[model samples]
Structure formats: C-alpha cells, structure tokens
Target: MATGLLTSEQAEQIVTTCRTAIGDSLRSVTYFTRDDYEQVYLRNDLERDADLSTFIGHEWRGFKTAQTAYEGSELGDYNYTIRVFDNGFLIRVTNESEGVFATTDGLTVKDFEEVATALNSFLGDREVR
Candidate 1:
C-alpha cells in the first residue's frame, strides 16, 4: 500500500534493484514527486525521524535547473548527481514526474556507475506509465 505515487511493490523493486548494484552499502531509499515524498525503506541501524525536506526541495528545484543548464553544451546531457560526504554518499536520480534519492556507505566508482545506470533505467521506464 503506497501512501504516495509509488506502489509498495514498486518501492520494493527500487530497493532490490539498488541493493543488487550496491549491496548492503545502500542505506535508504526515498521516493519523491514534485509535491510530495515518502521514505520507502530505511536501514534498521538508522533513525526514523529524518528531515527529508531539504533533499526533496533540492530534487525539485535543482534537477529542473540541471536539465536545462547543460543544454547544447559539450557536456552532452544531464545524468544523476553523486554527493559525497565523509562517511556516506547521496545518489540522486530523477525524471520529469518524480525522482529517488539513495544514501549509502562507501562504494567504488564502478558501484556508483552501476547504481546510477540501474536507477536511471528503472525511473526512465516509470515515466512512460
């Protein structure tokens, strides 16, 4: 039962797909549309009361600007963003309708590439539905 745009099964699939790419290093998965968001999964080691509004706002505003920011540039096109922190990484994947952000422990460059590819494929397919 989804409290938002994504179904429970779809949420599970997102987690499964990401975990397959990044393993237990993946910490949490949150789904967000333009107006709302939901934490579909969180690791047991983590706290429940995170303030996700900041990330949600970034995804809404930043991604929109990002898509247009690179238009006609040699950089080609906009893909995802990986924000690195001291102890973790924040991976953001978005399409026009919605997006998902995943927090993770340490990961290799290949792991980042694979997870980005996996998430983009998943979210891209969802936009058609």
Candidate 2:
C-alpha cells in the first residue's frame, strides 16, 4: 500500500474496523503521514467545519515520538495511545512512516484494546513493532 495517502478501499477498511470495535460511538477517522493528513470519516453529529490542521499536526508529532520513546524498555513495543476528553477519546495507532488515528465517543477498557489491536493489525507486521 502507498504511504502518502490512504486509498478509498483502505479508508473504508479503517472505518469498518473502527465501527466494528467501537460500535456507533466511532466519531472520526484521520490518516496522516509525516508530511500530510486526511480525514477519511467523520460522524454526522460532529462539526463539519472545525479547524483540525493544528490537531492533526500535533497528533502526527506525538505519534512519531511515542514510537521511539521506550526503545528497549521492559514495557516492550509501542502500540497505541488513547487520550481521554470530556466528550470523547482519541486513539492513535502508528508506525514510523504513517498512522491512523480514530476518535470515538467513549469506550470500555476492552474496547480500547480491540480497536488498537485491530488498527495495528491493519497497519500490519512490516511497520515494526
């Protein structure tokens, strides 16, 4: 698969995986590379015109940093991040070259693992642990 941007089929797979894990609470899906980003899906109830450029940039940097933060630590490989908010959650699954971050209304502890694991699987084994 290409690293620059997600193909429509890939984006659809992401949406389906996310919805399957998070159910109706899935809020938004954003795919980002080192240089650019795209919002593949946004729930109908959310704001359509919100400024996300700054947020996307932050997420990209944060994800990249997380990938290397614990090199050789006993905690093992980096997997994902879940940031809680008053209204929702931001779950980021990343590799060195590209990433997919999904926002959802809320999730059970198990839902978090399921979504992260599913997305990480979607990113695949070639991306490094």
Candidate 3:
C-alpha cells in the first residue's frame, strides 16, 4: 500500500529519474533505509579537470521533510539538500573557510517546479483503494 507520503519507493523513483536526467554525470546513489532518505551523487571526472571537480558537481539528498528534524525542529515539510563543494571534498562540514554552500543544486529551478506540479497532479489522479 502507498503511504501517499514521502516513502522509500518515491525516493527511489525520484533518484532514478534524477540519474536519468543527469545521465553519465551520475556517480552513485546512496539510500538511508533507516532514515528514509536518499543521496544522488554525480561526478564529471572523465570530462572535466580533476581540480574543477568541486564546482562541476555535487550531491542531492531528499527526505520526508515532515519526519526529518532540521535545526532541532520538525517543520513537517518536504525538501532536499545539495551538498556543494567549491574547492575540494576533503573540507569539513564545520570549516567556514571551505567556501562550500549547501543549496538546491540537484535539479534546476524550472525542473523542480515541474516536479512539484507533477506531484500535485498525482494527488488528483490517485485512486483510492
């Protein structure tokens, strides 16, 4: 049965679609079964210079915003995180000098909006059992 919320199946679909869109750039997909989240990572090592790896790519993490705790509080929202590296990947999360900014870089703004629209459309199309 579908929970109609952010589930593992949905996460798989989202990550799979992302991999498809990213094509050869996709490096790996990490799923946290216990946490119910996914990480879609990409790399352009072959095409891009090794030194430019940071700016060239990043990772995507999606979760049920309602179930996950952010900043110590649960806001009951659906969202994702993009872990971006500007210089290198060895930088620590707490290092302020790394110049790494975490934002939504998985999908472009237009694509994200389109996905939202599709999800909304699915709500209407869903048939009750």
Residue 120 local lDDT, model 3? 37
Top TM-score model:
1
Cα lDDT listed for each candidate: 0.85, 0.82, 0.34
lDDT of 1 by residue, 16-107 (tens): 98899989998989888887888887998998776787779977798899889987899998888888989799889888888888999999
The residue-by-residue lDDT of candidate 3 on 11-114, one tens digit each, is 45644554444444444433222212223333444232222233223311223332244635556443333344553212111111111111223445455444
Tell me the TM-score of each prediction against the true structure.
Answer: 0.91, 0.87, 0.30
User: In model 2, what lDDT does residue 30 have?
Assistant: 84
Ranking by TM-score: 1, 2, 3
Candidate 2 Cα deviation (angstroms), residue 107: 0.4
lDDT of 2 by residue, 1-129 (tens): 234476678889889989999999999988777677778889988887756677778888897677778878999988889999999999998877778888988789899899899888888843422
Backbone clashes in model 3, listed as residue pairs:
65-77
lDDT winner, 1 or 3: 1
Which structure among the candidates has the greatest lDDT? 1
What are the runs in model 1 whose C-alpha is more than 4 Å off? 127-129
Candidate 3: C-alpha lDDT: 0.34
